[model samples]
Target: MKIKKVKPYNQEEDKTKQLSRMFNTISSKYDQFNDIMSMGLARVWRKKAILSLKPYKHDTILDIAAGTADIGIKAFEYITPTQITGIDVSEKMLEIGKEKVAEAGLNDKISLKVEDVSKMNFADESFDAAITSFGIRNFDKLEESIREVHRVLKPKGKFVILEMSEPRMPIVKQGYLLYTHTLIPFAVKTFSNDPKAYKYLTKSMEAFPQGKEFIAILNQNGFNCLKYKTFFMGVCSLYVIEKYSS
Candidate 1:
């Protein structure tokens, strides 16, 4: 299956470049906007994502698209990991993440960097576990990014992902469509200068392949033991997978 590209501003430029600019534009209010949009339930979603890690004392974790280090911070709190590295394409977002990391007094335990997932610099088997929350849909090349993630993880390394998904129940699906199409954009316009960014958010979430299709993609990219759980009647999905190495 071909991956559909969603540009932040509907610009003709590269999706990565557009996405970086979009995140930078909204980095300041990103957290607040998330709370408002999700009715403060996004935090619960992130907490669930972190719990899926099953971290060990010596675990070295890589948080892909680690916007503002929320997942990384939670990993430290829950897993008490030896070290956590978060990588994202948005420098401005990473800058905010650095401040949050310091404020949490976790600067010594966590590091955030500006790095593209599709072309990561990490060596093979660099991390014991990897995760991304609401980040996979923005990848310009989904398959390449997945392959890069597979390359950096150790044998049998765990991979956990949280992302928005279309609801399956008829009632929930109708409500979700109305929320994303009307309510979300209205909220974005009222609260943010980057309305296009949220527009892209809804568009991308709708276009993204979920459930079994997503599992198939992960299996094809060297990740195995794929499993997923749906939340809010499938409005969101949490995927737990592991790397397979010979």
Candidate 2:
């Protein structure tokens, strides 16, 4: 896929507006396209991320940017949290997620709300833990979102972020690059009418910082016990960081 210069809203100006526009535009086919592009490993990857959280039976968890409620749904399966709130900026996305949530008879246990990550309309120390999957790269003020993650969390709350990352080893990096930059985009384009959305995915992941660089940012954002474990040869990372009296 030839990279196009689609003018993105600077994260500094308005992240919610930018992401709301983009996510709502892509809502209808987002889940389907996700399954195809990731070759169904996305769910397994999320399951691993949620399992790392060590949620107790009495825990209350929030899944930020919880597109279609998949991460929350997976989390519920693993640890049976007391209450799970899934928030996102895209109403259309939330609608789709709600439908799935209803079908699973999880409307009582899981709540879906349209919300902005940089400014969650929740009281300080509102949740025991919070998680977001494949959504941070889209944040306009990535740093601010991290701080917000700190704010809503209880003093010792856990924060787990599951996101895409480029490979690190030279040979594996080249292989994954050619596949994502070329093959996957081509396949998604055939199934998706909005080639631009697929274009944005490739560009965003390529532009995102991950691994230790990302871990360092979390440490700076008032998080404690910051650590990460990689999957598929570091193609993605499950970051487990805690907020200690933050």
Among these predictions, the greatest TM-score belongs to 1
Tens-place lDDT per residue, model 2, 66-97, is 98899877777887688899999889899989
Error of 2 at 37 (Å): 0.9
What TM-score, over all chains together, does every model reach? 0.96, 0.91
Cα lDDT, model 1, residue 87? 98
How big is the positional error of residue 244 in model 2, measured in Å on the Cα after superposition? Answer: 2.4
Model 1: per-residue Cα lDDT over 111-163, one tens digit each: 99899999998999899889999999899999999989999998888888899
Off by over 4 Å in 2: 1-15, 55-58
> Which portions of model 1 show Cα errors greater than 4 Å?
55-58
